[model samples]
Target chain A: MKKVMSVLLIGLLSACASDTTKPTATAEDRSAAPAAAASAAVTSAVTNPNLNPILTDPKNILSKRSVYFDYDSYVVKNEYRSLVQAHAQYLRDNAGARVMLQGNADERGSREYNLALGQKRADSVRSAMTLSGAKESQIEAVSLGEEKPRATGHDEASWAENRRTDIRYQGE
Target chain B: MLMRSHQSSRHTLTLAFLLWLTSMPLQAALDIEIFGGGATQISIAITPFATEEKLKQSITAIVAADLQRTGLFRLVDSSGPALRDPRQIVYPDWKNRGADALLIGSTVMLPDGRVEIGFHLMDVAKQVQLFDHTITVPADRLRAVAHQIADIIYERLTGDVGVFSSRIAYVMKQGNKYALQVADADGFNAQSIIEYGEPIISPAWSPDGTQIAYVSFENKKPVVYVQTLATRARKAVANFKGSNSAPAWSPDGKKLAVVLSLQGGSQIFLINADGSGLQRLSQSSGIDTEPNFSPDGQSIIFTSDRGGSPQIYRMLVAGVASGTAERLTFEGSYNVSPHHSRDGKSFTFVHRNGARFNVAVQDLATRQVQLLTDSRFDESPSPAPNDRMILYATEVKGRGILAVVSSDGKTRQELSMQAGDIREPAWGPLPRVR
Candidate 1:
């Protein structure tokens, strides 16, 4: 009778311990699972590892706030592709996050033309992000033209800073 | 100790004298503030009054002081030429002295308690009276008569409406705050309208010149507010989720075009003067902002990047309702901050070429562009009501000053504050009632 009782107590203790350890193991797995799944998704999308460069840090984010053009050019550059891809991956992983992209320009020309140029910059970023798998619902874009500037100085350095799109997280 | 004290006192006195001399205009020393520039100089010769000797000490100096401050004419000194009556300007002698035009005026108090003033603008070269007028005003308005005379001379010479009688509304920054100050066009007699401890920007006067629309960052975010100048009454026009700025009044003063981001992205939104009847004008996957209504009110000229680069676009007011925009400018890589002249003959905007930025005027009918300013930082070129002059803000020696230049880029004048910076000066429309 004593042996049966001891056996029952050991079984109950072991069962409780196993149940507590299971959640800790699953929690660890849950956190690591998304990142692993994300890498796999990226890997599958592009077999070329070089093309699938992981944009891990904000330093790799586009240092330039704006990309200027010669008059009315709207073509995206080969250099900004990796930066755009990183932003796209951030949007895809977060799912429900919405961003407001504001485009701006240096003070020049008519207000209407600057507004159009600013719109093009924002649209370029939006299109690139969309092509990279960012949902359409996650991005809202606007042009400030020559009105709002990141730098107030009317020099080339300031103009370059003024002529780009700013990505802002809208709400939590 | 006494010698050292005397030395220090002398040094202080000398410093003060030098400071006053350097800070004041040359006319201020001559008891007149002549407009500073080289042009067809307009000279005025006032003969010493033979009668009313007691008032001569006061009236003569006051009249001369008033004329000089107009920045329109130079008072012929007692030593520069032979003494003659302003009425009887010897054209040959005046012309030889480099005076292209002349002004002669005198003041007399009538028996009926009124001051009667007579003034004449003589074309020294043509040897003809360009204009002569006699105004009988109350004694209190004697100085105003002097300004009227200055205005007459200014108009006759420049062929453009004189802004000497106009007023200026500016934002005076103090510490981290700003005040809306309304003063004479020469930056005097300024009084604060609203003394809020926040950054106030973009003060624009209504068409009637009674109210001002500006962006005040009172609530941590910039919001458009309209304040009546006469009453100090203010109302918030719009507060969008993001930047709500560049409040431009339509020519008729019935509507305001503003940039509102409440609709997900910043777009041009039209609202009534009293902040009602809000309507969205344009929508793009890109930014659409800085909307200026055409003088005809049939369309709106705004800056957008719908075609992949910031460019000017014109959308008919009715067509914006139908959803269409036509491209306007293609010459430059950058063009922004467009304002139409009162006559609708031309439009002035900031244009960037290579590394330089300047205020350029484009004749709307011909599409011909003329550079109005050569400065790299020339932006916000607001045309005066006469369409003959433009007032723009530019950085001079790292300080911003409001500069006025003839529409043809002939005459240029820089108006700077004693401290701080002056920017975004939208010259108010001519007074409606006055």
Candidate 2:
């Protein structure tokens, strides 16, 4: 029991350190640093249990509606953890409030492949949400593929913006 | 716990390596944008066919257009003189006018309310008759007869079967209405197979040329439907719980490979012609879609991101458990929408170079990849039945249009519509025996 607590303390300290220095890091470093922070966020949310206030607050991380992903990847970054955690907590708090996760891919591959990749991305978010306390029944995941892109240019900047998952409330 | 961490680290290293490789500038390969045919084009002169004053169609004009559109023949100006009768042909005059071949024909009204068309293909260089034929048909079939004559001349010169008699199907979007249209290879006689407010895409023609399988969004979601050309009747073959798209017909026309999201993600599934025998062919943790059958029907090729980036892979058609899929493309980070050549010797697909996507052909034997088009966004390449030309969709000034490139990458032609975007061109099979 003592060893387990020490290991957890070390992980929490490293995650906090990575979060502070993320802005100056390279893209690769930034991507790797997020996982620790996300796990820490997930752990804290499980302990607090009251997530409705943070989720509905406009200034809180849970209000962030989109989770951006790396090119050709569906893995959720650690930086988006607080946002995903807040939603997961809210779902656990409010049983009737349901949300849908729409996955999207950049316009870079075959349409069918994009659709599949989008679904994978959305499912990844759903997995994260479920792990953070959201019930599987409270979340619906779908893929709009490249058909519904947030940005329409054929450049990297647009593609980065387009590769994301948008969280929406029911009837919104 | 140690094993899991080791595996995760290895996966991250692999992704980092992929990013590094994709960032490297690809070697400058044979990337050429072909605008039109070259000077080696065969020159031929076609004189106006002798017809009654009331005749509504010009057979000679149709023949001239057909031959010219191939980018293989150059039509010498036929306005010099009217040589409707073969007896009045001065071979020396035509030869001096830079004509290697001369075609003269006459159309006569038969007593049985039919039209009799007679034509003779003369080799101007050899000063000898190459072909002579006569056909009697109703007036409505005159255009087809003209195409037949063009095919004969084309075969005599090039020794390859002509595709002038074949047709191409595509999706045309006009205003709020989207239509699945079939048109002559030259973009004439366009007939709408189906029309809807939602989009229609991924048109695939059956090997026998009697049916087309396509994806329609009529049900507020994507669904695969196969429609018989003659009856215009269609039934949804893949209307599962999730999206069903990217339908490809097998060579023998017994099965179709489609992408379904029923179980999760996108996976390749096979279904019978009548929507029976539903079996999953691909099992992947990542996206595995856009399945195409090999010409021999022994293997299937599809796009998958199991390796962290989209690439083309080929596996036996027996089943996924039968054997593992072998990756076929490594030169680029992105390659998809593969269509095997009719001869099974090569395949064409969309390859991305930097920000631009172009059509490329890969030889299975040599594994040589050749870029065929120099477009910013080229997709959905469908090789003609003869494998001599490839039709693909590309963007022109923000509008989608269909373009054809010869297999040699020496000639190109753009087929555009005035009203809306044209996309997802599928070259139909050869005409069936009547």
Candidate 3:
């Protein structure tokens, strides 16, 4: 009976300790590791070409179709080197083609701040396209802060897709 | 006995630690359980001299009404003290009547048709005088004199400066047309500033209080525009291709911060006052919006969801080039729309918890969060230049209404028009002349 009572007391004490323990697991440190691994896997499966929305879509023949930017950055994530090259090549192929890059903030921030973030996103896309092949006179950029949400729900899934710039060709 | 002594020692040590903990200043953390009790039971006694009954009755009632409208004090019936002189205030009589505060005054008519008014604040509990002052004004201006005195007494008790004289600017949308209206802080004195047949969003005031920057959808796409308050001159700041919105002015009036999304994503950028010398600030993949400069002009605090959720982030002015950023808010899943206090001591923002949205303020020194508004959906809390009052948009009667509340969240008063719905109010800075 004494041995059983001691074991029960130990079990209760351990349960209490676990309940009062401060969290050792944080969202970033835990979720970030898995997200990075998944992203790496995705990149490996799909090499550079398929991810280039500009090169594959012939609709982008005017160099005004797609703008590229850097990773984890809206300042024109730079890996779109060839993708921007294709757009610049298109702009060279068809001169006098004008496009506007609309930057959009995901529904993850205050509308005012998101508006500014979207502007920077658009500016980055314009810079990359201009550097690759598009002319400064042919491209315009603007930002729409989280006011116009592509996805209505407030979740990570929706937010990830909303932080982007749209390329609109000014069909004359 | 020895075991008992050991236990007693342990108890003493624990008691000592508790005392030390209590002595330390509680970090500004607040667990606010708001009481929705609509009104206060403050009763003020006004006893006037016999000769000035007509002027006293009208003036005192106006003063009492103003105090009552604030929902901070109550004016009690004091007809029993009729004909009492201001000099002969019986503090005990007011104390016996269960009065928290008493206002007694007398007016002396001058030969030149002017009047001299003397007022006193009697502390019923302490059975002594709290404050007293005398003013000389024309007899016709007696009501204004009474309001001035009420303003004085209100300021003394409440540490916050009064906003009884300030104004609010809001956008009222009716069908396809939108109008910019400015009115007294009390929703009176409504006057239209501009009326357009299209959508107008995000009205921002210049530091000098002479110009307003807004986004107008006149050309079928969002474009940034600025209008002068005096000449009504309108100029397009930027008409970029994709989106041009969310205009903010720096404190020095030299630069304007706007969101331009010509790139593939939206980011914060700075442009010269004339819309030149544009520079990009944030490079995060997540959407960053609502950029506001700290009063000191050293850093910018903006809303960013780069970390997978919307939160307030701080970056130095140099961060535009250096690319260094730090997260400022960690509590609650949602903390957005940050407006810094004029003194730089605190900032006001809206924090969302589940389905409920609240207007909250954060103390920079203590890192304490205080919710000022309690409603279903509250947004766009703009602080007065005094940093004592915040005007925000809230839902009422199934429509959006503009409401103002004190910074401490103790006194809340709704500012609305009986004619139409009003939302997205931006409290202008203190008048430069005033």
The top-ranked prediction according to DockQ is: 3
Question: Between 2 and 3, whose lDDT is larger?
Answer: 2
Candidate 3's residue-wise lDDT over A1-172, tens digit each? Answer: 1122222223322222111111111122443443354344334432222123453356664334444333246655555556556666666666654555556777532456556666667777777777777787666665555545566566766676677776655421
Query: DockQ order of candidates, best first?
Result: 3, 2, 1
Candidate 3, residues B316-403: lDDT per residue as tens digits? 8773543467887888887888888888888888899677778999987788988776677788888886676688887676666787
| Deviation in Å, model 3, residue B7 alpha carbon | 48
Worst 10 residues of 1 chain B by lDDT: B1-10
Runs in model 2 with CA error above 4 Å?
Answer: A1-67, A77-101, A132-140, A150-161, A166-172, B1-40, B51-57, B108-116, B136-142, B320-323
Kindly indicate the candidate among 2 and 3 with the higher TM-score.
Answer: 2
Candidate with best TM-score: 2
Tell me the whole-model lDDT of each prediction, alpha carbons only: 0.60, 0.73, 0.62
Q: Candidate 1, after superposition: displacement of residue B147 in Å? A: 4.1
Which model scores highest in lDDT? 2
Q: Write the per-residue lDDT of candidate 1 for residues A66-146, one digit (tens) a residue.
A: 444433445557776776777778789877545556667676554334554665577778888899999876765555666
Q: Model 1 over residues B137-174: C-alpha lDDT tens digits?
A: 87766444555555556676767666555677777664
CAPRI grade, predicted model 3 = incorrect
